[model samples]
Structure formats: C-alpha cells, structure tokens
Target: MKRLCKKRELISMDLTPLIDVVFLLLIFFIVASEFKKNETILNLSLPNSASKENIVEKKAIVIELSEKKLAYKTSEIDFVQLEQKLSLLQKDSQLTVKIDKEVKYKRVVKLLDILNKLQLSNLLLITKSQ
Candidate 1:
C-alpha cells in the first residue's frame, strides 16, 4: 500500500491597492492645503474700523508693518529698501498695508509718504472689524 501526499498553497497579500490609496490621500491633502508665504511670519494687532465696507482683494502687493519691523512681502527691510521695491511696481498696482495698532503715527505717515512719492494710489489699509 502507498500513502498519499498533501500539498498546501502559499497565501500572499497584494500591497498595490494599499499603496494607491495612500498616494491618493496624499494628493488630496496637498490640493486642499492653503500655503501662506508672508502673512504668518509676523504677529500684528490691527486697529478696528467702524466702516462696514468690505474690501474684496484681488491680486495685490502685501506690506506688513510693526513697531520695530517692516516687511515687504515676507522679507524684513528698511524704509529705503521698501521704497525701492515699491518704485519698481506699477503705479496702479493694488497695495495692501497691514500695520500693527501699536505702531507710531510717524511710521504710518512715512509709509504713506513713500507711497505718495511713488504715485501708487491704489491702496487698501487692512483693519479688524468692530
């Protein structure tokens, strides 16, 4: 008499589906994220405004000003350098100024003066809603 032999099949899991799911999730998150280049660099307390007008901003240049620091976009610079940068922009370019509430009036005036000399008339001063 002869004894019969048994054979077992090897089991394996396909990781391709798992990898695809992870890749899709990564792509979804990347597309949904908002990247702010300059706004988060400085802490500012904007003054309150009583006016109810809501300004809808299109593509515009951003200038952040604090008591001790002035930033063009995200890079910290002095008034002279800021002026030079502003001069290169078009006269009608929309400029958005975000100044700290604690900043002195003199500094605000100085910035306004630079904008005036450059003849950049399209200006928007950002403030908090009361």
Candidate 2:
C-alpha cells in the first residue's frame, strides 16, 4: 500500500459555562441597584453650616410650639414629666430637639436647663436659615 498522511486538528474552548456566569452577575447587580433608591421624604427644611461634616439624626424629641400650646412629640407634657420623659428617652438612645420658629425662646431655654440637669450633654437645636 502507498503511504497515507493524516491531518491534525486543534480543539476549541466550550463557551456555555462562561456565558452562564455572565448572565448571573448581570441579574445580581440589577437587583442591588434597584434597592438603593430611597422611598420616603422628610418635609422639614435644613439650614447649611460652615462645617460640612454630616450629623446623623437617629431619633429626636420633637417640641412643636404653636400659638395655642406646647407639645412634645405629639402629646402635651408638663414641666414635671419633662425630665422623666427625657430620662426615659435617654435610657434607650440619644435624642435631639426640633423647635418651631414661632416657639417662645424662654420655653426652649427652660427645656435646655432641664436637659443639663439630667446630664445630657449632646443637644442640637434645629433652625432654618434666613
């Protein structure tokens, strides 16, 4: 018989696994990106300060003073329970105060005095810039 020559062939890589991994990563990032959008809005206005550091407000004792009466959070509170209320609030976490513009300055000062007596050092007064 005459001599016969066989041709050699190179193998190619399978792309099925690589394609599957790419699809999984795309789905994961899409889900994560959607969750970054915030849902609720805080209607209150905040003034700018020279210090650019961020101050996080975890919780606060809102004192809304209208022309009618003084209210803490939602309910009206007398000076007697003011200390107890603040103490109770302090037991769980830190707090700040959000006072309205129309509120009397004297009332705010009195509350500050009480807070000092309770030994609560950190106090933030919320106000709008004119």
TM-score per model over all chains? 0.76, 0.47
Model 2 misplaced regions, further than 4 Å: 1-54, 66-68, 91-93
- Superposed by TM-score, candidate 2 places the C-alpha of residue 120 at a distance from the truth, in angstroms, of 1.4
Off by over 4 Å in 1: 1-19, 22-40
lDDT of model 2 at position 105: 70
Estimate candidate 2's RMSD in Å: 7.6
- Model 2 gets an lDDT of 0.61
Top-TM-score structure, candidate number: 1
Q: Candidate 1, residues 1-130: lDDT per residue as tens digits?
A: 8988877878899999999999999999999998765453469999999888657575778898999999987788999999999999998899989999999999999999999999999998889998
lDDT string for model 2 (1-130, tens) is 9989888787899999999999999988897784533211233334444554447464555654443354566667677776777776554344455555555678767777877788876666565544
- Please state the error at residue 16 of candidate 1 in Å: 6.0
Q: Weakest 10 consecutive residues, lDDT, candidate 2? A: 36-45
